[model samples]
Target: MNLFATFEERVAQALRNLQQAGDLPGDLDISRAVVEPPRDPAHGDLATNAAMVLAKPAGTNPRALAEKIAADLASDPRIVAAEVAGPGFINLRLDPAIYRDMLRAVILLGEEYGRGTGQDTRPVNVEYVSANPTGPMHVGHGRGAVFGDALCALLAFAGHDVSREYYINDAGAQVDVLARSAFLRYREALGEEIGEIPEGLYPGDYLVGVGQQLAQTYGPGLHDHTEAEWLPVVRDAAIEAMMAMIRDDLAALDIRHDVFFSERSLMAGGTDAVAATIADLRARDLIYEGRLPRPKGAPDEDWEDREQTLFRATEFGDDVDRPLLKSDGSYTYFAADIAYHRSKFERGFPVMIDVWGADHGGYVKRMQAAVKAITRGEGALDVKLCQMVRLLRDGEQVKMSKRSGEFVTLREVVDEVGSDAVRFMMLYRKNDAPLDFDLVKVREQSKDNPVFYVQYAHARCHSVARQAAEAFPQADLSPENLATRAAASQTAIDPAELELLRRIAQYPRIVEAAAKAHEPHRIAFFVHEIASLLHQFWAKGKDSTHLRFVNQSDEESSLERLALAYAIRCVIASGLRILGVAAPDEMR
Candidate 1:
């Protein structure tokens, strides 16, 4: 159903014909040859650089090769004309019937039409939004969550065996801080006058419920224990409660991970898994004791000029060696991370993708180095960095300070604007670029709000179908019976409808390219274009009464347009599904 892929195959087959006719060399490599939409619509419906790519390899002039290819391609009924353009490029003008066929393809394939050959069967593990188990997820975490969840769905649609994962940072000092904060709340819940929370402690009222739950379970027994006796009990309770809150926050946005890994479990019960992993690296000569060079453009504080346990990251594309242990014989966070990734490798994930915030850009190389050193470069790890989100309300900056616990939580934002708006806004820009999230703009139902614009396009299509059903009671254009009619309607199409069908036919190619590039924003951009086209097409029908979807006198054209509208709705719904947003059949 992919028109671009179909055209490329047609071009390749034409080239083989040339080879058999003794007009071109047989051994020329055609792998780099590509057929795509022309940059300018004036050029043609499609263009190819096969002649230019094969000319040098075939030891022939590019212009001559292009002319030969163009002549051969023109023989196909689908290609009305092929002309040689600048620097041996072949511009192809497809016959109007080809576009008609494309429209028919959309009607026939419906939602499944755009899914490509994807990963076939490669198992992929995507880990994202692994926020420390200290508090509720904030707006920044929302971007990563939306991006990761969409990516997992995209991969799954592309036929990959995908598993979504979240790694909890439970074995850190932050969790201890959470425990103390929760303990204070627990005391306050038991009718104790636990005064103002001290500085450097969690100050959010979200922990009040956790405290009440602890009081219900332990009553007054927790107050009698010392720090050592109560720390473990309290820490465990706090982490569980925090994770539950986090899960709820994610569920609010329709996001759920298949696995939640705990860092504490990697070394719990005297397992020393981190040390064991380091030993394995050391045995392979990838670990050593060395002093690291001071980081560039960073303040030099406590320049410890002594040898320490280091990983030979340089051998695996790292700029400098990385520390695996601290001076106090404790595992560094990097050490624990390495062990965690190593565990993923052991579990047989050939492809692993980690979605991290932009602030961790520097961490990418070292993490990639660790993966290579552990797997001997057999497996691949791709780290995607999502830049910061700047929240604005009513054109004024929405203030946020994590240290002061005054930041907006993801739950709060979703509650205000709904999950559909939140998810769409997060994906409206490239992950590597900073996003300006305007609460006021996103809430608007106009064209500026992409979520509503796209959703409304879907709703409009259904409205057309409903109108057609009322006009022609025999059509039965309900969602359930629309599929069979769509397939039947693919045999004929108008110019405007065909253009939309061409775009619909490109979905699989778009998904493959976007997923391969690790760019979810492409999906957003595509949805926007689709919405724009649908709106324009609808406006066209409004002007020409003959072009309207429901013609009271003609059942055949009415059925065709109704089926086309149904096809557009299905594709729009599929794209929205990938973004973790709802596609409404009716706009309220």
Candidate 2:
């Protein structure tokens, strides 16, 4: 049950009542009215600006309209009190029974609590972690990977069918280099004396196994041909090995994509989707042969002033037209990407989200423009750019260099702190904000560590549940049984109980907002908020023994508090599941 949604409908009904009584204009547009938590907790439980939004349109003063709305809302049994404050905003105090009902809903729904009702009628394509197949994923890719995965889970929880996708860059010049690097390894596997890797080739020892695999596939005879003759053969082997390694690396972080689309597939198959996409744009007069302006801010020695193939991205709000083919007569990466997104639209995904790196911020408008022009504005694309993540060890920066092949792999980080820590810390900050991931701090059992703090809140609930079970052995405290117990009882809500339930009640709104904004960091923040409340409430038990969840002195109040504890636990567990973090019963 979404308390905010229910109150919003109530507010709308109040406005309709005003219209029916002829106190307000009948033709007022009130769709913008909303109900949300008040700015200050002391003011009221929830607040709304319905009167302020409609006062001018309804030809009435905001205060007068607010008074009428409040009067109408106070008649409802759920809202015990409603008052106008600060010029027109209405503050509402809900009856304690509403908060109790929310807690009961939590125990009843379990993991499904806070799920929104606005189900997505169509499939959504979430393309993320599209790291090139040229090498292993780095710490930078880790942030985007976790964010994308969590965002996908959030959308799925919000009643959407989400498809997690990874676009592999195997058809570019980088894979050719990968193939050559692997050929050197193959020679080494055949007992040849290969010294240090030459420039322009991968130098990591990770390629040693690729070489051994090539040797087994063709024996010593594989070395009989030139790079031009055997390059394709070697490229296929390198791609296969590298992709396998990438899958294993993703699995280390508990991330697995539904599709690993190869760039080569666009041009390699019987149907050339790239050519077809270009033709589609050309037919619509969006494609043309035009010379691009010389790039500024740097001197280019190889700058060639000539006409080339271009797409009119500016027509759809891009900064400038984009090139689809290079001077070397090869299709640019952007061309292939257009075909990839076009494939998404053809497959019936009207909504598409791309998780890209911060460096690709400038690419968003062009991609959005391409989608608008190609799909004729039927498909919408949102690109979420995640900023760089600075990895720190014990408060000192851990330097990384992919050039020197000394970079830390995603697996190494996950192995060091475990996947739960890695996933939670990665999402502790906004996607567009820089995050400093201190390896030592995330594993700390103290309250300063958010992942541990949240997990501990969940663990505390279980501890209390166990105590309750021991305190009352005859009582059936199963989730189903406790929900029935909660449903049958209606007791006064202690301010402490109200605080916890109100925080947990915000979960559905947070999930809906985060899903719409394409931001999973909000979930991390909300989970931490509820976790903080749980911890504070748990601490209250130390000084006030009467406030403890397990009270051997009184079975009825203890059961009620136990049910409340379980509700908090469910919310934390659900939020952590979406964040891809573990809700540990005990922290090791």
Summarize candidate 2's per-residue lDDT along 1-588 as a digit string, tens digits: 999988999999998988899987788888899999999988889999998899888878999989999999999988889999988999999877777777778999998998875566678999999887777888889999999999999999988899999999888889999999999999999999999899999888788898998899899877999879889999998998888988998899899999888888888759899999999999999999988788687743323578879899999998778888888888887888899999999988989999999998867888999999889999999999999988899999988655328677787788889899989988999999999998899888899999998999899989988899899999889888788777677677778878888888788999998998888999999989988988888788889887889989989989988998889889999999999998877656
TM-score for each candidate, following the candidate numbering: 0.94, 0.97
Instruction: Specify the highest-lDDT model's number.
Output: 2
In model 1, the runs with Cα more than 4 Å from the true position are 21-25, 300-303, 400-404, 476-495
Judged by whole-model lDDT over C-alpha atoms, candidate 1 comes out at 0.84
lDDT of 1 at 61: 94
Candidate 2 wrong stretches, greater than 4 Å: 296-304, 400-404, 488-490
- Each prediction's whole-model lDDT (CA): 0.84, 0.88
For residue 335, model 2's alpha carbon misses the true position, in angstroms, by: 1.1
